[model samples]
Target chain A: MINFEEELKRFFPSLEIEDSEEAIYRQDMTDAADLLLGVIREDYAGYSETPTE
Target chain B: MICFRCGAPLSESDFCNACGVDVRRYKKIVYAANSCYNDGLERACVRDLSGAEHSLKQCLKLNKNHIEARNLLGLVYFETGETAAALTQWVISKNISGTNNLADEYIDRFQSNQSRVETMSTTLKKFNKGLELAQGGSFDLSIIQLRKVLSMNPKYVQAHNLLALLYFERGDFEKARREIDRTLDIDRGNITALRYLNEVNAHLGIPDDKNSKGIRIFDNPSAQVIRSGNETLIQPLNDREPLGLGAFIQIGLGVLIGLAITYFLVVPAKERAAQEAANAELYAYGETIDEKNATISELESRVSALEQNNITLSDSLAQYEGSNGAVDANNYLISAAMAYIDPNQDATQVSEYLELIGDDYVETSSSYEFKELYTYLLNDIGDSVAQNYYDTGLSYFNNGDYTLAISYLSKAYMYNANNDNALYYLAMSYYESGDISTATDKLNTLIESFPTSSLVDKARQRLDEMSY
Candidate 1:
């Protein structure tokens, strides 16, 4: 048997037109490629820091 | 594929040719995102929208620059009545790829029609209100609000699912099942609707058949689902067997009682419902008529304003047309030009026509053709006209008519500035008229314009006397 109150709690309020701007601004756009680039750039920076003997 | 760092086009090699960064992993990430997008597209084609939504989101999470995946995800959101969510995804996608992006078309399609946007906005508001009402333990009011929302936008799956939940809570398993069926009809892969269907079926004691999945019972009361071993059968739920005489008498009595009850109770309630529907329809028609009347009144006022504007413009236009207008001035100038070119017409006739054109036309109106033609004609006969006016002025000056002499001499000097005698006589006439200021001006003009004239010493003596 489904619990009506508990099931209703799963439903969230819809994003109104007024709130769309904030929702878009707060949306996470970071992807796997972005993460990989960040990691590679960090490693490259660290590698360049080593002195050439 | 493109390089993540410099945005350069990728080559077949594992490294970027431009920036020299290793791109083997980046290619793999993009390839994986494309695979997710393909999976989402397949799911979407099969109307498994929830599955499609999940795969598309995974694609976007892997590659936020995947515009196709974003657009498909937006479509999925729109299908599930998440219009604002759909708009956000499309907006982000448009920002990610500005040109030749399908997101631009999708956003334009959704937003170009203002009425559709308003309907969507209102439907969303009512759905939200319904959800709030449900949460506040007002199940009946929520059902009514959700019904209204669904009536406005029948394809709103979320509203249907919420209505189903309300029905299920109110112990209306049949209506709940119907609502769930409608939700699934709009979005086949709506998991909430499927789960609710499962619960409603359980409550109604309907036999669950796992073989034919997603099969929903419609409003057919006689239709039955039966599983015989591995196969399913759909026969009538209440199949009437042959009845004996006693059974017939009992059925006939029951039918009579049913008719009596229906006539006494159900007919009146049905009539009230019909009357309410008619009243509601009449109110809708009244609102429409009022809106049309307002539009008609606005257009009528606009027409009246335009007519008034037309009358004012016509009046203003008429002032620049006709006998006392610019046309008359132009005609006078044209007549003067014609007379100057005529072999028989003298300078006096041309001068008379030119005077008819008036000073206002020459001083105020800067007509290019008028100025050109008038200047040419005046220059052609200026010397002869000056001699005529100078003779007339000398006669007037000797007769002691200084005002008439001044007028004629001024015309003579105006026609030909080289007539130094005309200038000297105009100064003498102004001096005799006792207008010392005018006399001084004419005397100075005579001395400055004609330095070799015999009147220079006389003009200097007069200026000295005026100063003293």
Candidate 2:
């Protein structure tokens, strides 16, 4: 048996078309270079604290 | 590979052969960049522009001057309708190589067609206007504008993505899905489109597996909550086990029965339903493709029409740019006023410019000021023109050239319709030329227009003589 109120909440009011202006403004394009750089930085940061082999 | 420390080529050993610099890490980086470039090239060959873009970016990060990767990235961008960005990349590539970059060919292709370049410029303007409209809360107008932009550049992924976002904001998940799918078709791994597709699927209640790519991307804590008769049930997807003793037996029996039922009835029924749904979706998509083709046909015709109109407008604009009748008229009026102020200043230039403005301009005008100016100019110069035409007409009439005589006499009558001699000579030219019907019409016009004229008697005499 499905809950009626929960089902109703699934249909959230759509964001206004004007709100897309801010959405686009806030949009940051990310590609694999950024991902690779981030991952490398994270590994480098954690590598210093690792125990020596 | 080259040594980073001393700029010397290295052998296969860990150290540079010439400079003895430790080049292992540098060599590894270069290898990794090459590998990424190779991956990008492979993906680009298969037209996976989105994935190719990503791999190429990673390659450039590792080695900024990876020429082939950079050029391929520009090509991918061009295919996706980012012409400016593609041009920027190719320019950089050309600058880096300076001699034999394929980017040069791409740049040349873009520059070769003037009309196509102008259309691209118009497309970009329309896209920016659409973006402005979307920001200003005019989604319908924005969508219409974006459709035009797409018609101009079908692979414009940004327009498709923005249109999809608008559809999503309108709660039209199906349209949003359609638009996102089109974007993905151009660039298969476009993250924005993929994200939108996930959202649309969720809104449509298409159940995804717990470990699906979209679900794992977010790492949702609660997969789903099953509420059976007001009792909240939590069944962790990762943890399910057989119950103990009688519960296990009953569960096993239930599972067996469920499997039996599924095998016997549900599977074939579900397959049939799925096939029907797929067929319906295919038909709907076919209709959509037909509509798009029709729109493209209409847009092509409209573009040709607009191009022709542009040529005509350009010619008309050149005429305006060369010399304007209105400006000449204003100048003449000013010169005439100046001449009125100074006795020494002659106003012949005024009549000259007024003639340039022409009688057609004066007669069609509804402006009282222009009419007054025209009347003032005409009162000063009109009698002279009528007299000139009368003199020319009589000369031509004496020369026995009735055609030239009628042409000038008609002009004399047009300028000064009250000229009885000009009208009589024009009618006589017509009669002598054997156009008796036109001569009769002209004589009748003369009598009706100037009933008290002395020429009316001669006109009646000619009419009676012609009748004889």
Candidate 3:
């Protein structure tokens, strides 16, 4: 059951939405994908157009 | 499937045949792992790289030795701009399954380009810099560096996970959730990701649905691993169902609170705003009315002053009209001028006309020209009129017409107040016509007025007789 006090505390007005930059081509770093992520793929063709480095 | 309790294969039984230990939970774990693997394979076929990565990570969590899952998860990471994470998964998979593994081919491809491998190591060093920044409480700087690292080397799992962790700490839960979701997609069974997600879920008020694998529940903390003569025993605990009515009450109260807040707070605030606006309008109108009244009062004062001025001007205008003082003065002066200029006209007539001009009008005349002209006319007319009136009075006195002589002599004296003859004869006429009182008054006037004249002797003699 939902405790009313705990539930009421959730509405304390501190939660504020923040904005962030969106990158279209984003990769998720899965731990399962990388128990410790390995340098494997070579599809850096699209990202190379705008070199961040 | 092999039993977790016994190093022996089992044949479709809930318990291990060799150890007499229940293996129902373990079998379900294996089944769940297989189910995830199947789900991953379908996602991979459809090129849903993120989903496949997620499903495969779940599969690996249940059975870390799932070679196909580890290999596939790496491949999925590669397609989604995370080359380092993909290669890392493949390398681990190949290490686990040493010979002729499918991960070997992927690893060979990476090893073939030695320069690229060096660059990948450099990316790792940058990742370390981002880590130090985060530890130093420079979360914003760390986030920037980590995003840059991900863009350059998108497969950097640590970068994505750290970035998410920073967001989670900064109260940027949406960003944290996005990062955590991305991390889970690449590594579905990542404990750090799952743990962070549970925290995110707790803040979000959702259950940890991902952690609910087909694992045995251990309720009694004491019984799960009890040491009995250097041997440990494990037991499982079952979960109880929830009571439903309490959930309903909280829902009903939440709705009631939302309604009360709108009615008591928001509605009153709106009404107060409306009333304040009305008061402001009323105040503005009052000011406008005050201004208008001030203007009207000023206009009325001006009009009253103008009306007073008009009345004064009208009275002044009436003074110059027919038979008023100004007109009478001008008429008498004109008649006197005409009579004086005419050689045949009588001097007495001019004197009579000049007399018609009142002393009040002449004294009040502000004009220098009017006063000078009137003075000259009066002097010229007075000499001739006094002589003529004096002779006429002597004629009347000799004829015994005393009343007539008195009137003529009085006129003669008025024209020239210094004429002693006119004064003496006028006094004698009054003495002869009146009683002793008149005789006495005449003698007193003759004696005082003409003390040097011949009339003074007779006047004193008459006065002595009257007194006797």
Candidate 4:
């Protein structure tokens, strides 16, 4: 898997990824996995290749 | 803050206490270096090249990795005219920071031939303007502008050359030579300034050689002078010469002929005529002298007789005056009395005679006689009495003795009713003595009688005040 953060570093050389508001919000969403789990299931139940790992 | 390399917690010290990372110490060094670099950058921004160089040196001393300091230090050196040193510094800075492009830009701009060309073009424009002024006959103004251009770019060879030309045009050969010398000092091979220098030298007749040649004395100086003197010099056509001998002889002969003609033709005729005229004049003079002598004798007799008659008349007049002294005294007394009574009247006949004598006495410095006559006229018995009455009246009136002033003033008024001074004073005396109605009546009569008198205004003012 590509490290999006490092790839973005090449595009925006002056960027500070950990200090970015969008990156922080994404981290918060990942941390609330239980709250996102039902929404994810309802939205992609028919998708066969939704990786479980 | 965490250590980036080791994921260690950064300590206050350079070395992480747990992992010995040396992070804080390195950060401190970087901060110091950056501070000095920033200071150097600020000084460079203000165009303080020397101060910027010093700050940048300090930055480099603090941290050898300060690439910005090295690059800016090069800029400072370039600004201060140290081109080689600037190139060295910039190369080192570029080595340290390959991303820095400032040093490259400066090197490219400064090393180009176009820069010198542009400078030359600006200097040429200044020289052209100076030339224009010089051609316009404003030499002083052109010299001033050319001097400013030379100061801005001293190596402007064309400006120095043209400035020399302007000085030469103004007849200032010394200044022209000095300007050419300046150009030569800058560039020894300056052909234009050199050519102008040679031209000035040729015009001035100064030898192009450095050393002076002494005068040669080959031949005998006295012999050469004698030879040159012996040569019959040809006189120019316009040369002035003395009159020829023939012309002088002719002038002398002409003058002699003129003298001979005047002597033979004019002298005898003029002499005979003068002799006849002299004889006639002598006869006429003799008769005139006789007539003049006769007239003189007659005039002498007449004068002597008139003198005798004058003496007799003078004696008779003296005798008559002596005999009529009392009558003259009486006449003077009456005239003086009349004058005192009517001060406006002309002097009587006796006073007129006295005035004539007074004028004669004044002209002859006979003040004593004039005083005697004046005293007799002024202090005669009748005139003195009248004057005494007038003075007593004036004194009484001035003293505010209204009843007595009225009586004395009335008597003086009878003698001369036109005495406005006495009348006005008398009216005031009456007014002061609480007889307002009497004072008003007196002033009314004075005003009506003496309309042109000086005291009329005072009388009217007094009457108006009393009425109010």
Tell me, by DockQ, which candidate is best.
1
Worst-scoring 10-residue span by lDDT in model 4 chain B = B223-232
Residues B186-225 of candidate 2: C-alpha lDDT, one tens digit per residue: 8877777777777876886544442332222224554545
- The lDDT ranking, best first, is 1, 2, 3, 4
Worst 10 residues of 2 chain B by lDDT: B209-218
| Inter-residue clash pairs, candidate 2 | none
The lowest-lDDT stretch of 10 consecutive residues in candidate 1 chain B is B209-218
lDDT of 2 at B23: 60
- Give the TM-score comparing model 1 with the true structure, all chains together: 0.52
The first chain of model 3 has a TM-score of: 0.23
Stretches > 4 Å off in candidate 2: A1-53, B4-8, B205-468
**TM score of chain A per candidate:** 0.76, 0.49, 0.23, 0.27
In the order shown, the candidates' Cα RMSDs to the true structure are 34.9, 39.0, 19.6, 36.5
Report the Cα lDDT for candidate 3.
Answer: 0.70
Candidate 3 chain B: 10-residue stretch with minimal lDDT: B223-232
The alpha-carbon lDDT assigned to residue B419 of candidate 1 equals 87
Candidate 3 regions with alpha-carbon error over 4 angstroms: A1-53, B1-43, B46-75, B79-81, B85-331, B340-348, B360-413, B419-468
* Predicted model with the maximum TM-score: 1
DockQ of 4: 0.01
